[model samples]
Target: MTKIEDVKLIEIPKVKDSRGNLAIIEKDSLPYPIKRVYYLYDVPSDAFRGGHSHIAQHEFLIPLSGSFDVIIDDATNKKTVTLNKPDKGLHIVPGIWRELENFSSGSVCLVLASDVFLESDYIRDYQDFKLSKSR
Candidate 1:
């Protein structure tokens, strides 16, 4: 079974130049192969997002512009992590509930997933998720 301890902070490689900075994310650098890539932005400061758990999808979240906090619940304990750097990512494994909150204005959240979008893979109900974890 997956636990909160499985969540990790990953440091992405960054290259600096006279123009600006560049960070690279590839399949080789991640624990799992990347199958889908998406980003979230223009989130309101008072709004919250992502209150679900995945059954099989794993994700890596990166703050490309500003900052936010990710609240992770493992059905045993809850932990909060702040993402504020472009060169770092939070790795979320399956079977854990996550919520993104306290997003700063203009923050951009980049996500890389281990699988394609599948509605059947998501556990959207908190009560249902808790029961699944106990089994």
Candidate 2:
């Protein structure tokens, strides 16, 4: 069982330059090896995404462009965080429900996943997630 308090923000080391800046993620930056990388973009301000919880997979979410809110719930408690920095990411463990919303214009969300896509690993129902937590 994982607690909502276990969720955290990971800071990616940024390299400063006169031209601009660069942030990189290496093995030392994450607890698991990333197997898949994806992104969300062009989302409407009124729309939301990710209303599911993973069974065994972990994910790291970063706001690559604008900003958005990530509402994470652990059946018993919930916490909302806003992401607007490219060098910071939210590290989410398994068995926590998450919702992405309040996206600013031209916002882009980058995700680094610990595993490849597996439908069986996802519990999409909020009620079902609650039941599982009760177990």
Candidate 3:
């Protein structure tokens, strides 16, 4: 069976000026066209979120406010990415396990998804996750 991997890190453009900072991720601006969008905010202290992997969904996450660390894993590899800039976000591919951790106070995480919510599309268990990839 082949191993899956997390999405590559793509840098979003930030126009800095005296008027403040501005960032945007339009459908055409992303590596893949976005189909859905969501954000995580008001998270409790030291709370860990996202203990599942998608079977066919592509996700891009950013810390719109403050900062947080994203832990991503696959059957063969794992990585931790820190997202602090609203202009820069992490893109996660399907078939990868992900956990969001180390959130700063009052942090807001914004996510862009490739598909709408489908419970069957998620592989939540590590053991089942590995098996699913082999098929």
The alpha-carbon RMSD values of the candidates against the true structure, listed in the order shown, are: 0.8, 0.6, 1.8
For residue 89, what is the lDDT in candidate 3? 82
Which portions of model 3 show Cα errors greater than 4 Å? 1-6
Scored by lDDT, model 1 comes in at: 0.96
Comparison by TM-score, 1 against 3, better one: 1
How much does candidate 1 score in TM-score? 0.97
- Candidate 3 local lDDT, residue 59: 91
TM-score of 3: 0.90
Relative to the unseen true structure, what is the C-alpha lDDT of residue 14 in candidate 2, on a scale of 0 to 100? 94
What lDDT tens digits, residue by residue, belong to model 3 across residues 1-135? 323343677788877889898886666877677778888888985898899999788899988899988988787677888888788888888888899999999999998998999999998898898777667
- lDDT tens digits, residue span 20-93, model 1: 98999865999899999999999999999999999999999999999999999999999999999999999999
Clashing pairs in 3: 7-93
**Rank order (by TM-score, best first):** 2, 1, 3
Clashing pairs in 1: none
Candidate 2, after superposition: displacement of residue 2 in Å? 0.8
Model 2 has an lDDT value of 0.96
Query: For candidate 3, what is the lDDT?
Result: 0.83
Off by over 4 Å in 2: none
Query: Model 3: which ten-residue window has the lowest total lDDT?
Result: 1-10
